[model samples]
Target: MSASKIAIGCMHLLAKLPLPLLRGLGKVVGRVLFVVAGQRRRIALRNFELCFPDVPEVQRKAWAKESFEVFCQTFLDRSWLWFGSEELVRSRVKLVGATHELKGDTPTIVFAPHFYSMDAGGLALPLNTEREFTSIFATNPDPDLDRWFMNGRQRFGNVKMLNRADGVKPIIQCLRKGGLLYLLPDMDYGKNDSVFVPFFAVQDTATIPSLSRFARLGKAKVVALYNRMTPEGYVAELTPAWENFPTDDHVADTARMNRELQAAIMTMVPQYYWVHKRFKTRPDGEPSLYSGK
Candidate 1:
């Protein structure tokens, strides 16, 4: 069997294990990764340093280590979330706060950031409501892994997974028809069609302005869904739709989005996806953040 198939089979077997035991194993694996995954460890540390410069290095390192643990636990959680019994999933993943916003859609866009428990948050929507849901994702290179992700995400309610290459017309159509759009536009997706905005301490962070653009085009109200992983399972909290969003200026709207995201990330610093190169694409003539090692 191919490596991906073997991995999938192992995860399928893992689904039968109790949540506590599976999480314990994930903790062990995360510690090992912290010791051996030098490049990723450095990246996480660098991101912490850039974002939380005022904070002491020792404390920042602690958060980075805990981030690894959370990341691993959330990754292993997919086994049960995707393949386990519905009774188990429904019991664990809790949806809280402003859930009424999801009712009657009225063209809503869910601003889901790259929290460790994001997949859990993704499941929260379809599992709860019967509304038509749509999300855009980049196709994974490995076909087996790609299939795994697509199947896991679409396993719930009426969900349509659109490739990033697929243009915005269909997305807008769904939104206008009172469908939910789960958007994760926080990462650094290169300089193309992105604007330099203030993200925490970083002044010229390369952030895609899609959140603002989509809200404008689709005429949708933006709601933020922040997910956190607890001992029992995950909590997907949906904030009420933002008022006066997507104003005349798209750039200003994007900046406001970052500000809101920053506030949410502060509540659970270690749970955020810090390993990504958030400051990768710099303005004209700026040095690379992760140049050496």
Candidate 2:
């Protein structure tokens, strides 16, 4: 075989090694990423401070370390989760409080944040009797690479995927047909596309306005769900929408709901907070998050 081909084959073999050794090596790589490379640490550090302004720097660092641990567990066990049999996955994950409020024949919209093992919910699909997931996906390149992702996730019983650009129409159609569509409401989209919501009293951004607009226009049931890691594995909880939930002022309502969700996120998942560049698109005149307070 060619030299490059042999090198690539060797890497593949290493990736398939025993879980313990693979996990150990993964830690080494993560250290390289966090300490040496500092890829997302800047934002992680910034966010930790923003969220815990009163806490000491030492305690903030503790939370940051815990976030790394959670991420490590999720990343190392990735292959096992994707390829493991249905029984194995079902046994690991359990859903609680998936009440009737979560179900109904309407365009149901569920806002699921990126918990440490949030995607593990995909494995718990067939195991669920209450609802089937039809995902709204942000498309990426590489069909062959993404095939395994689809195989693990797209169970095809009632589950579906939508390319991000064309996601709106399908989601609206699903609502009209009385189906469920999931969206990640926490991530920033762009200027005017999202608004600065008071998350932890800081101007954190979110995309739930799209959800609010969808709900307002389609009158879909807006549900909040989270997949949190438990000692056994993970559990999905359906937090019913507030009584007389916002229907009039969508932008304002979206911001209010995101604040409520952020509180839930802090309580359930202190770590694996899906630390992202939340303040990158700050409004004009706002202090840059990168600068030290």
Candidate 3:
């Protein structure tokens, strides 16, 4: 068997384990990775340093360690989240808060950040409501891995996964048809087609202005879904739709998006995706934040 298939089979077997045991395994694995995964550990630390400079070093380190633990725990959670029974998944992942925002076909966009429990949040929507859902994904290099991800994510409800290269026409169409667009536009995708905006303490962070663009193109109301991981499972909370989003100025709209994201990130500091080199793309004549780590 191919390595990816074997790995997937192992995960399926892992699905048979109890949640507590699976979480324990994740904690152990996370601890080991924190010690051995030098590059990733450094990236997480650097991100924390940049985002939480005012916080004490010891506290930041503690949060960093816990972030790693939560990351692993969420990764392992995919085993049950994907292959486990629907009853199990329903019992575990709870969809709450402003859920009425998801009701009716008003063309909605879910501003889902890169929290560790994002996949759980994605599943929560389809599990709770019968609305057609769409989300963009960059295809994995490994075909088997890509297939695994596609199948796992589409396991419940009617979900259409769009390739990032597929452009915005279909995304807008889906939104106009009242389908939910789960967007994670908070990451630094690169300077191309990105606007420099304030993110936390960083002044000129590269952020995709797609949220505002899509909202305007699709005439969609933007709602923020912040997912949190708990011992029981995950809670996907939906905020009320923004009142005056997607103004004429895309840059201003994008900046407001970051400010809202910063507020959400503060609620669960360790649960956010900290290992990514968020400040990798710098403005002209600026040195890389992740250099010489």
TM-score of each: 0.99, 0.84, 0.98
Candidate 3 on 1-293: residue-level lDDT in tens? 89999999999999999889999999999999999999999999999899888999999999999999999999999999999999999999999999999889899999999999999998999998899999999999999999999999999999999999989898999999989999999988999999899998899999999999999999999999999999999999999999899899999999999999999999999999999989999999999999877
Model 2 Cα shift for residue 144 (angstroms): 3.4
lDDT of 2 at 255: 75
User: What lDDT is reached at residue 245 by model 3?
Assistant: 94
lDDT of 1 by residue, 1-293 (tens): 89999999999999999999999999999899999999999999999988889999999999999999999999999999999988899999999999999998599999999999999999999999999999999999999999999999999999999888988888999999999999999999999999999999999999999999999999999999999999999999999999999898889999999999999999999999998988999998999988874
Evaluate residue 216 in candidate 1 and report its C-alpha lDDT on the 0 to 100 scale.
90
Full-model lDDT for every candidate? 0.94, 0.66, 0.94
List model 2 lDDT by residue over 1-293, tens digit each. 55544543444565455556756665566556667536567677788787679989987777776666567666655555665556656766776675566555766777677777767765554456446567777654655446556765664346777777784776777667777767676766667677667766476554547767777666777777777766566787777766555568777887767776777777754445546766666777776776642
Q: How well does model 3 score by local distance difference test? A: 0.94
Off by over 4 Å in 1: none
Clashing pairs in 2: 107-175
TM-score for candidate 3, residues paired by index: 0.98
